[model samples]
Target: MKFEKNTALDFVLNDLFEHYRQHVVAVDRITSALLEAGVVASQADIVNDHIAFRTLGVAHMGIASFEKIFLAHGYRKMDHYHFAAKKLNAYWFKPPSPNYPRIFVSELIVSELSDAAKGVIHRYTDAIVADPVDSLNLGDGQQIADFLQRPLWELPTSQDYNKLLEESEYAAWVIFNRYYLNHYTISIHELKEGYNTLEEFNAFVEGLGIKLNTAGGKIKTSGDRLLRQSSTVSAWNNALFADGITLQIAGSYVEFAERSVLPEFRNIPKSQLSPQQRRDGFEADNADKIFESTYTAQIKDKG
Candidate 1:
């Protein structure tokens, strides 16, 4: 846990964002486009609704280990969600203050995976039998900062990656891109112009030649219609494997979100729909589709 009384909440977020954008290339392109779209007055005006991370359910890692950092910073765990088809368990946290972004973490259920897939995954993850994060000084800013981007295992061969890709795309992704920031969602309702609603904003994104996840039809709305969300397909990157081979795989991407006023608050003026008035939790049906953003649509092993 962070020991300092004045640990500077903003400093932690700023540090995370700086490191995040460096690896998630979509952040740069989309933020720039948002500014150009006049949806925001400036880069500073853009609001991140949340950021998501993917993890494995094996020992020494997963949500239990990752949530400690946030809990230390005053964030509280909120809703818990499970995706049976995806074989994942996840939870979203609310920041101590409204200024910080929410955190969504999902861990794959390794025990449910095919033995072949599990074996290939453990071949690499076994390198860190102990949770590396547990050894770090919780009070150290640099150590907490490094945890997010640090590599936990050696690269797998292209063949193993392809095999994992066949059974569980999430396993392939986590194995190749460990603990990387998966995607950051923009609060489109907070925008000033061109992309205010998820619908229009999605059209605007497609206009820029960015592809959206159509698994559940570009716009995934909550059953109550209080939350609307959309995201671009992940960018493909050429990754090097342990066997001296390179393969193009899906990387991180950007997400757009618009939270309509809850039905109970519908009568209130638009200005009255404050941060809390708008829906604050995620939709399992919506997230189930959003998770597919990381899968290569072709399904064939391009490698």
Candidate 2:
């Protein structure tokens, strides 16, 4: 999340983060705790590992469309990941420079959904016959920022939302919170000693009264055991549906990641080790569980 505010990418990231931080209470909660504990002097000091977004796999949207914004700003598409169980397809974009956090964008496979869920989703998005991002001037950061927050389709009715929630919580989420920054990750390994490992960090976070998503486990580790991640259950907020029904719904959350140095780089001095020397990219198994941070089960499982 720390970047020089001098380019279109910087402005867009900053704008999204500002809106996200304000709504996702845990963002500031963690930042304030870190400040008080002397882990950081300000929010800018915290290194953002990455930011993620969710989109619908409709005709004119999804990663194909959403990715244009970052791709135009010098981000290079890196790897593709598929989640069969969740019916999701995703790609992680490497930042042009290490200073900018990486980007992960995922889209629900609409065609794979049940007819009922597809009908409900299309009722809102079918009208978008043209790709929305195509209409924007990508060079303009403000326009891009506003586009990210803009609603491309009408809000779903409470019944539709609930129905989708039953079939796919991810669907229900995108229907209500389209193109919004789903979650921003904090790079735990970049923190000072005693606070960098997931174990110590999770304890510190829980000690501050924050709840961690326990899907799979409090910590989701990669097969190589080089990447470990944990996240807070999504924040709940009163959401007003198109039908005038208001209900508490899931919003964005915060994620913590620790990328251990690669085995080959073990001999490198800790002080001299660079980000490139650490474990790179993400793991499908790890990300699969991390996606449940917003699920009702995790949100309700206070234990």
Candidate 3:
């Protein structure tokens, strides 16, 4: 935990993350399962590498609107990344101290998508004539917590949902689950024997019958190879549409990240290394497939 000692801010972030875990059913399930299976003794021993969020790339919403909550809590925005294939622009923010998890927020470029995809997204977001986050009080932890799960628009029709899914699984996901927590990563490198590295952890997880996103490969590695990541294919939940029709839709999943020693820090013992000596931020190519952790191609395999 690199978080600076700030009780007030720590409480607020914990409250928000707790609220999120309650809604993201997979979080509770996976964590419990891991503990029950004796992978780790307790939750405190594991570190959350980071958490992710997806946003619509339209007016009155997006990284611009969403980042305020974290920035207000002492997070400083770090690297900016572009995803040409997914039409996303993202940035990762570091915590004031090592205790808090890093934050990654990405917004879709709706204008770059096709008219059909645009129309489906607009149906939900066009109603937000004003930037809602602007009117909210960031100091109020509960308010910010509610805002994360609040529905910005009415539920989309199954048809529109499918249309967006066809064009962009990310679009379909954000449309139904607005401002939802995409996934929280497990810092696998910090774990004990048989789970310290991604390869071992991945094998151990598969032995438990959990499916992983194999889009590029079971492991998505940085070009520098200091950061390796993988995730369970997001579990499908039955979405209750406005029309009362129930259909299985992809929900959030758990991610595993193993950050290796940086080249310059090779001589130092990992325990004695500084935070900067570790792989600091994300890699675009690796994330490209990690993003597919919730796509139709990936979800179909889960089903």
Candidate 4:
């Protein structure tokens, strides 16, 4: 269904926001931190601005929230598909934008299977496939290890398990510039010129009050002549948050709220719309504007 920009924005602000309240708090905290740092100007607003305008830390927090919301609805990461794609692409790519991670909720038949039996595998082939996500039935002795494996599977048999996995609908949401930090190489020359060693640079980043999963203790530099790389390896811990899920790929955390349907949409006075409408409206408008600007620049160059 084609929703107006206001309608879509309202859905995100009202529906998605209430549905993921705790997650929003994490996002807000990250945004606040970025503002405190020189990474983002204090006047900038997170909910109504492009994520690219925010710091790497803030962007990761938003992406983490996106993952958790879908996962709470019984979705699982399609690691193979997600990693293989050059960019994050959501299943629902049209109205809401598709530059985020796509997740799938399984519709497997868990009942007749043995204890070690792998449940059915349902893949969300597209964002707007249908009410329920697509399913590939798996019987006993299937040995579909990777797809069915989840922390939830260890739970004792109950209707709750079936309700969690079976009666859920899945949709893919995209996080734009998911690999921003990993993509562009920060010039080591710049770091060396400013600081004597990688530790000094790390200290600077930490001084910004940004927490790093520094379990690896120190950054490691690859000896490659053409491609110099340095990284602080750590797991993204989500244990502190209500949701136990963490991003294993990168060291980051996301806070997630318990799943529930959104409350009824409230009517706003036309005057009240001035602020939120202007803020969210600008984001909706400028998204296309930026794309157009980029396209125009490319076209002029070609001409």
Error of 3 at 179 (Å): 0.8
The predictions' CA RMSDs to the true structure, in order, are 3.5, 0.8, 2.5, 19.2
**C-alpha lDDT of all candidate models, in order:** 0.81, 0.94, 0.82, 0.25
Comparing candidate 3 with candidate 4, which one achieves the higher TM-score? Answer: 3
lDDT of 3 by residue, 143-194 (tens): 8767777889998888888889888888889989888788888888777677
lDDT of 1 by residue, 151-193 (tens): 8888789999999999999989999998888888889898765
After superposing candidate 4, which stretches have Cα over 4 Å from the reference? 1-5, 13-21, 24-26, 38-117, 120-130, 133-205, 208-303
Clashes of each: 0, 0, 8, 5
lDDT of 4 by residue, 76-110 (tens): 44322121111222221111332221222111122
Q: What is the C-alpha lDDT profile of model 2 across 1-303, one tens digit per residue?
A: 655778888899999999999899999899999999999998998999999999999999999999999999999999999999999999999999898999999999999999999999999999999999999999998999999999999988999999999999999999999988999999999999989999999999999899999999999999999999999999778999989999998998999999999999999999999999999999999999999989988888977
Q: Which scores greater on lDDT, model 1 or model 4?
A: 1
Q: How many clashing pairs does model 1 include?
A: 0
Residue 191 shift from truth in candidate 1, angstroms: 0.9
Best by TM-score: 2
Candidates in order, TM-scores: namely 0.91, 0.99, 0.92, 0.27
Sorted on lDDT, best first, the list reads 2, 3, 1, 4
Give candidate 3 regions above 4 Å deviation.
Answer: 1-12, 23-26, 33-39
Q: Candidate 3 overall Cα lDDT vs. reference?
A: 0.82
